[model samples]
Target: MMKRIVLCFLLIAFSTSVFSGVADDGAISTGEYDYGIIEWNSRNPSLVVEGGANVIDIRNYGRLEVRYTSIPINGDWYTGGIRDIHLDDYSELLYLDGITDILGIDENATAELKGGSINYIDSMQNTDTKHIDLYCQSGWSWLYDDEDLDGIDEIVGITGLWENDSAFTIGFINDYTFGYDPVYMNINVVEIPEPATLLLFGLGGLALRKRR
Candidate 1:
């Protein structure tokens, strides 16, 4: 009974954390990306960004498949790839939080759930794509140049998602060894305040300090 209670409490805590909001100081702008699955014909990988719904999808080529969409992006497209694959080069990690569903959430949060889709191509065959979508009003935010994983940074994308209030089907598939795992449709979203914004904040802080 104690273990059950603890498990339930842990689940609630995790759920709250997932649904909580972070400040919008460095929030990622709203955007969506979708890529229709393609046959692996030795062509270089291509990505698509859908602005209406704000999602990102990666199409791979194998039995293993994964799709990440309805993620917000504050920076360029290659940001997620650069951070994930080139971690040695870049010292920052991005984050996204306050998401209740793939692209939308209930009113208890700031954003409304919207409909979005993402498609992932299976690696085993030449043609395998998973159609996915995400939608939200204000549930998404991002952080950049984050060296700390203390949930201080904004979110760039989501991982290991299975289901939620929205009707998006998400999960992981195992079809290969370490070298051939399902890849991520990484969304690299970074937020940097403008010089003027920073200056204004600085001035405000100085004023407060003087008054004190």
Candidate 2:
């Protein structure tokens, strides 16, 4: 009986350690927006969502860090090609930083400058008021555009134009994909607890076990 109890305790501790660094899937809204950390650990790791907007009106409140690896392309073309990632005018604030070599915007994509401007950082571009094409496998790009013209910038939409054939998969619990297959990429968001809270919980568990 004592051996079984010790084994159960060990299993519980191991499970907690494995799942402590995950965040939950974020939401996109036109009215009230939910803010949290978004993480993708598949081909790319450490991706976060800051905020943005669109006709649907989804927004975020932090910065997004994207790590890239290999991008998927269709047809007999063995050589890698550029993939276009588009952000609409609804995005209030767009800031992006990460590896940019594997992904890039299609050359034919259009950019419309309305009121604000775009700031390019290394390979990444930051904009507060511009619609542009995003290219992969470059360096890093940050976009700081706002749709509402409000002082705060937020991410409004992750889905690009349907005509452009730009679709990605994001899951809060399990893994899900939207467009395309061969299952190239996936984003997983897991919740993370504060260190202080975790420590206190650990102590409480120990105390309860002792009493039992």
Candidate 3:
């Protein structure tokens, strides 16, 4: 019951990091940033089908340490929010915790998805290299959704297949030292059986179910 209460408040506090609102704006070509809210712009940048779009472009030895809440959950009247993050030409993007939409990683670029940005990191041009799962994220839920009424599910964990594939779990119940953690997922997970567990849910059709 205590965990439930904690998560409820956590969700409310974390809502602004994964979804709507206006955030700080700026541009970085060189220099290293470690703290503070960096929207880079009040725009939600989305990646193109061809791969490698840019909003926060890291190049020429530029480095961004996303240990805290870097990309704020935001958008503006001009249809702007953090849509794409690009790392190229030996630039670096070290992510520890935060919600990321789309990332374009090129040759000699470094985009390490550690703490929070684990599920949404994209290696736009580095499909050949194998990606290592640095952290073991536990206790999260991955659901299937096709809100467009199309045939595609939004919860694809397979790398690079959908550009937003999460290679790790999304649960972070105790990731924050403070009460205000800005890296939590927007949705709440109540209870849902894993697909493998669902496959063995006895002969009784009503024995197993999903409750969000």
Task: Give the runs in model 2 whose Cα sits over 4 Å from its true position.
Answer: 1-144, 147-187
lDDT of residue 194 for candidate 1: 44
2 or 3, greater by TM-score: 3
Better of 1 and 2 by TM-score: 2
Error of 1 at 179 (Å): 4.0
Instruction: Report RMSD (Å) for each prediction in the order shown.
Output: 20.7, 24.2, 20.1
The residue-by-residue lDDT of candidate 1 on 38-137, one tens digit each, is: 1111112222111221222222221111223233357443222111111111112111222212221111111111322322212221113212223332
Q: Where is model 3 poorest over a 10-residue stretch in terms of lDDT?
A: 45-54
lDDT of 2 by residue, 92-143 (tens): 2222321111222111212221111121111122223222433222122222
Clashes of 1: 39
How far does residue 13 in candidate 3 sit from its true spot (Å)? 36
C-alpha lDDT of residue 198 in model 2: 70
